[model samples]
Target chain A: MAMSVDLPALEQTAAPRAAAAARWSRYARPVLGLVLPVALALGWELVVALGYSNGRLVPPPSKVFETIVALAKSGELSRHILATLWRVGAGFALGVVAGTIMGAISGYWDFAKRLLDPTVQALRAIPSLAWVPLFVLWLGIFETSKVALIAVGVFFPIYLGVMGAILAVDRKIVEVGRVFRLSGPAMIRRILLPAVLPAYVVSLRVGLGLGWMFVVAAELIGASEGLGYLLLDGQQLGKPAQILAAIVIFAILGKLTDWLIEVAAAPLLRWQDAFGARGGQ
Target chain B: MLALKEVGKTYPNGVHALERFSAEISPGEIVAIIGGSGCGKSTLLRAIAGLDRASTGSVTLDNAPITSPHAEIGIIFQEPRLLPWLSVADNIGFGLADLPAEVRRERIAAALARVGLADKAVAWPRELSGGQAQRVAIARALVPQPEVLLLDEPFSALDAFTRRDLQDHLLDLWADTRPTLILVTHDVDEAVVLADRVLVMRPRPGRLFEEITINLARPRDRKSELFDTFKRRVLTALDRSLDRSVRDVTDKSSAGEAMWW
Candidate 1:
């Protein structure tokens, strides 16, 4: 009787403990990813503190942090971050709109595909940076040229992704739309849109990455108020720590934006049956 | 009533998929189109569903020419073909978009219950098994109460036990509204189990070869001798349609029975 009572009591207590463990593990998994970077930073800091060298040319993480803090105190960090963010946002929006329209046309209509695809493919083959000179000449070296340059960088990937996704949509699923006698707009809304969304999200992520890349190039070409400008200024003034600080800021911003996109799309894509969604088993 | 008058299809590259095939099916009747590969069985079903045009003939439903997909007809393909983004309930309610939200919800609930998937209403298609997904597909097609339902080997991808279970489930659902069902299949047992009439077609310019009427009553027993007899007859017709020799037919028939049973 005593053993039975103790066994039931032990079981009761273990249940909530197991539940708490699971909950903790869920939060702990993401934190595990930060361990490597934190370890590397600490290791480098220890080396510098022990007088491994003067820590010049390739400054320690502490020096980079100090540079970042100084920029923040001067309000230069916010100005640069905002400038870069605005250019990317405007360019991404413009590129998405233009790419979506053109892709829809090319994918949905055979006539448009036959007429336009070859030319577009040929144009895509041209190195994107090769258009920098022409864009600067046409729009002048102001925000307009920078945004346009970023937009061009963002366009080709989105266009390819959308078109390929639309073309690859299962014909059998489209037949379901036809069987229901859905109107043209209804077919697009109900069927085409949802079907292409997964690929579209991937393309958006790729396009955003390119937007960041082109923004750096755009800012390098005679811009005064952006992270890329900070990079150029640091290089010319021989402030390697500031350059590292700017580079570090870029990495953080890029990762944060990409995570935002992923989090935003997670709910929409909860229905996906892909291998990645299953957490690789 | 649905009628096909000398329906034919010839591809642009000069291959004749179907040639002057014709049939008339009254409402509430279950008709099966069975043939060997390339016999245009699926092509006929597609034409009837108005997914593809009959190049040289006409398809009429209730005397209205069906040049494109019609509101009265719905189709279930070989695969479930459920929209991966939609929940089971949402997929069932997809065709009912024009109905008021209350009515749509009621119908979807009723459909989910009917397909024995009431608990899976919130589940995604990917989360369901093959048979469950196909059941959802059936619910999606039937929820709108289409007058004619076209099934293109809807259960071929399933295991035998699941296939039989779904076939019975389908028949039970059919007894509700008694919509006209035109099925395309390669399975002799399946053809006999569900269809009131079986139309066999020959390939190499597919055309109707024979029509075999199944006189067996409903709640069919798969192991019954009469069912075996009908299965044998359909199998023989299939062999003939494929132009197999008589010796090859006997040899293959026994092998098929061994596999199917």
Candidate 2:
């Protein structure tokens, strides 16, 4: 009824300006998302120009960028990045595999859960950093200690994620699996794992974030190379640009790894429409 | 053929959901069990599907005791339980894992076509409406070509129009496949319209009260007097069962009033 009454008015008054405004609306969200970071960087540059804080003590964005370029030219940046990546990669892989397997065993079998769940619950209460000194004492100040520390940090969240996913699977769907007479391995592979992918991916992201935090702690205590070592070296040498450079690298790498995981999991999780991301995509 | 011999279920909390429930379904017959809520209609269906065990007696399919789920029996739940991660075709092909790849594809395609959803072969379950999702679930169960089909209030949640449409579709599918079907429903008209024999059950300790055969011809007319007669018979049986409980409640309340006096 409204359409019938308003049709002529809409046709006459909907101007080209409105059409252009509608066309530009699509880019508004992305531009708005980017505005704050650009503004912050500009403010930082202005502060540096006005001599706010000693330039030597707190390097501006340009000096940090220059340090990054120099580090890249000397192949130092890639070396540190590779070292840090190796630690996170190895630790994350070990943690996810071990956590998922143990989680599944406990989640599926009552006897195993009865034996292991209490211990896991108790261990989860201890801080991940508390294990670092003990790990260094046992394994020495080698790569094992750093990797093991990150692994321990990554383990708890993933373990909890897996258990929650498995336990909360819809009972009706499980009944369908039973109706089809799907065996244990087939049911796990086809149904349970796929059902838990979104939750598991969330845990993976959390583990990766925690992994970075643990790597810095391990390197701060004892390490020769990697971005964490660079952080300590910057502090001791009083090179603010180097310190800012390390911090920027950590931020960039964290975002990059998260993007990579999202890209990898997108196709596998295309069937999901519950996250409110479907309409935009 | 499937048979339930004095099958009974008692929960751990000692609620007797079913008692001495016995029935035999022939190779290609449609049987409907009509009862009120908590009449153990769902429990009886689950026992036949090997999803729940009857504590007292046994449910056997083709002379084999149903100790666990078997591939030869297909069950459609009240909710459409499609795995959301899978495409429509994959969900339909779920129970065909043991078949050859080409055969599985053929069967899935056929099932989709049967359900008039051939165009939605690749659609996700979440993309479908309630009725469409239910149809996909039907396809999934049908693709297995099981010998026995069990339905537990499969159309009760749908709108009236969708319910009628799916009911007709189900009848067509049954006519074509000739699988022995056992449908549990509370709708008396549905029981009369679809079943070869309608079994009316009473609640308390759930047991069969009466079995009424519908001798009406194929494509039975709902407007016909005979159809109404059968519907009335089932309804009367249900009302009579409910009336007993209502009278018992009233009697207990009046006895309390007498104590006050």
| Per-residue C-alpha lDDT of model 2 across residues A173-251, encoded as one tens digit per residue | 8777878877888788888889889998998899888888888888888788999989999999998799889999999
Task: Report how closely model 2 matches the true complex, as a DockQ value.
Answer: 0.45
Quote model 2's TM-score: 0.91
Best by lDDT: 1
TM-score per prediction, in order, is 0.91, 0.91
Give lDDT tens digits, candidate 2, residues B1-261: 799999999999999999998888899899999888888899888888889888989999989999778778898989999999999999989988889999999999999998988988998887787898999988888877889988999999999899989998899998887999899998888888898888877787888777777767879888987677777767866787666654311111111122345
Q: Per-residue CA lDDT of candidate 1, range A1-281, in tens?
A: 12112356767779788778767767887899999999988888888889996778878899999999999999999999999999999999899888888888999998999998999899899998898999989999999999998998999999999999999998988988988888999999999999999999999999999999999999999899999999999999999998999899999988898889889998888888776544321
In model 1, residue pairs whose N, Cα or C atoms come closer than 3 Å (at least 3 residues apart or on different chains), thus clashing, are: none
Which lDDT tens digits does candidate 1 get at residues B1-261? 999999999988888999988899999999999998898999899999888888999999999999889889999999999999999999999999999999999999999999999998998887788999999999999998999999999999999999999999999999999999999999999999999988888887888888888878898899988889889888878888787442222122222344467
User: Which runs of model 1 end up more than 4 angstroms from their true locations?
Assistant: A1-25, A279-281, B244-261
- Distance from true location, Cα of A30 in model 1, Å: 2.1
Clashes of each: 0, 0
